[model samples]
Target: MKRYISIYSLLIVLMFGMVSCEDLFDQKPLDSTPAEDILTNEKDAEALLYGMYAYFGSEASYGRSLSTMLDIMTDASLASTGFSNQLGQMYAWKINPGTSEVGSLWGNHYGAIYNATFLINNLHTIEGDQDNLNRIKGEAYVGRALLHYNLVRLFAKAYDQATAATDLGIPYRLDYEDVTPSRSSVEEVYSNIVDDLEEALQLLPVNERYDEETFTLDFANGLMARVLLDMKDYDGVIDHTSRIINNPAFSLSSGQAFTDMWLKDSGLEIIWRVGYRITDANLVAPGYNFFNMNNVSSPLLPDYIPSDSWVNLFNSSDIRLSTYVATAATGYGWTSKLVIKYPTNPDFASQVLGMNMPKPMRLAEMYLMRAEAYAYTNNDEQAVADLDALLENRIENHQGVNISGDALKDLIADERKRELMFEGFYWFDLKRMGKGFTRVPQENTSTANDLSISADDYRWQWPIPTSEINGNTIIKQNDGY
Candidate 1:
């Protein structure tokens, strides 16, 4: 039988070649009629959009680098002593432009952005059902904005009111044709992100149109809350997150439902997720690396284990300890404690592969965002209420508490750590808060080693891939690379 994959896998053959790029940047994807012919057709237009989503889930994007690599790079998780040299380099804080990891990530995000811009540019000219056209166009806008948002946060300095206007942000590519673009100011890139997301809010259908895998109104708002949170716009964070929390369609998973959320094909709290099929051509290796916790003899056995400091943050009553951990007995012959957030599913045809889908935004994150916003704004009562409500789901007999000042703020921060540990939000959270971290070091000898990362370290801003530098003459490299 021919294996069926997500629409993204199929779209690679359908439209990727249509984009003619002499280098990573500076190319018209649809300069000729062949590309235009595809977009003019309704089904093909939607397929092109699906291609962007597929690229988003690729390892180069959220499937690995954004989620897995970033987790290992932080203090919350570590690379296995036997982890691959490529990943070891990333975890050791030795990231550079020449690393294949950075290059692939850069290509994946921009590739999605390129396709998204292509659709938004061409979709308007076609006459079709207004609502369907709006949804497609809206997805394109959100896709482009999302790619740029991730790029800017990783490549540029955290947004500073004093320096953002002058700081080197990533290029905001808005055109489909080949053009040499220079980095915009951090403020400019953020402004572009907000503009795109706000437009998405106007054009996108409500949560019902989400279909688990597609972007929706709530997703846009959740992302906006995240963007605002990173910008330290507390009121803005509250304003956006409230929209999702109040929505009737979403709520946190609790008890057996939460367990089912991970072990089965369910996403009770997901606002937007990336679709993944077991048969996806690129899915096998990453799925194996993250989900196959039962393999003890494998060299990758200890990868992505929760740090002692991170584990200590949780109380014994925390349900996540059991739900998220792979213990000595359950981890086959492996002895060290490990994370089983993406545990393998016995139900799948390939029982070894972790079949869980990647969720980019969820209701839990929105609640945390709102809680932090409240804490920062001195709304301690409201902040504690939000945290207690979320904790009620994760802890047994959880008694809610009310506190004020930094105590409330610290509680909110710890809540974020416990809630979003391996889903890829830790490093950014520290970066935004100006906090430093120390990696406890891997036990055995490997190319990777333990190191302390301070808030002001230049390494926090990832180097622009060397390949990108070699191809584009007008771009400038980040400092201390």
Candidate 2:
């Protein structure tokens, strides 16, 4: 089992890669005065707060980096598409320790962190009404903590008790500094993230909604569940996820409502996600460099193709098959791209599927998290109850789908496999369970067999970006990478 060790070092390199060589803290003012000074009132604070969310919108956060990496590494079986190429060719991923992509992810996360730090530190100074101040600050804290958590997960491998104390985690950047910060151990990163969120969970009052369009208590709670789960604090995971699940305010949806989960300003299972209008200027041409969707098709790469077995795993009635794949004319004789997963075609950046935003936390994930935590805590009966709830919704004819014992756990994991496939949970799930590089090499297709993934690949633990080692004096490179 390959672990992405030394998450902090990898992050250091990746964070700096987001832009051209320059000061790490270079701030391109939206209108001139530094955000620190301008954000002195409700209106400015509101704008600045929303600006922090855009960090998630960056290709590194949800747009491409983490999301793409998550999908490619999991068993959703890549759609026979060109976009899948960068991921499928494990050899190709820059995260493959010491690659430019790894460097980019490092730089991107830190950049987001820098923006968050600025907002977080100055929230109080902004002259706003009690309601506005509390609301903006509450959301900022949670959002900030989450970015820290996200960085840790991608850079550090599982919290191995044996080595975590010494393992390098992503640098814990607390302020808006551009100096060389060395990596901390995995334990240090999680402890800091936990500390941040604990304070956040307290600071974020239950109210302060945004345009009926911002994060609320539900989002923070759901994120806390995720953070706990990543920490393997199964009991804590249960506490938060169960709250989100049992809350009458949130529930699963069907038909268009389900798809709307990804829509901008829409709320269903999603509690919080990134929001990128098709019109955002960040949209740029592909092939020309720096995160363009158009460049997506222009440069063809062969990635994960649905294996006969993996495809067969989905019930024929499962609508996701159509949602996740399309007939291809290129690699594997199928259109080599996941056209549907990025289900929306905005006039702005049509390439975005599931909207331009990434669902940072959602109710559906909470349900799954609770079920998994139940199983881990030996609450079999409760686990079954939670699992059935999810299955009933997705399965077409759920009347008699019998499952028991390991079979049941398999079903639940598979349910997650299908339900949460491309949303970015699969790879982490596989790695946590210690499944080695897996590949669905062949089967039932008429003339062509799709190669899913080859097992034993070490590309799992992203390596420390090369630049970080060269530029930062305090940073130490991961061992294996």
Give TM-scores for every candidate, taking all chains together and pairing residue i with residue i.
Answer: 0.92, 0.80
Worst 10 residues of 1 by lDDT: 291-300
RMSD of model 1 against the true structure:
3.2
Give the Cα error of residue 417 in candidate 2, in Å: 0.7
- RMSD of model 2, in Å? 7.3
Summarize candidate 2's per-residue lDDT along 12-100 as a digit string, tens digits.
Answer: 43332234323453443332456566666777666555555555655556666566556654544433323333433333343444555
lDDT per prediction?
0.75, 0.58
Among these predicted structures, which one has the highest TM-score? 1
User: What lDDT does model 2 reach?
Assistant: 0.58
Q: What is the TM-score (0 to 1) of candidate 2?
A: 0.80
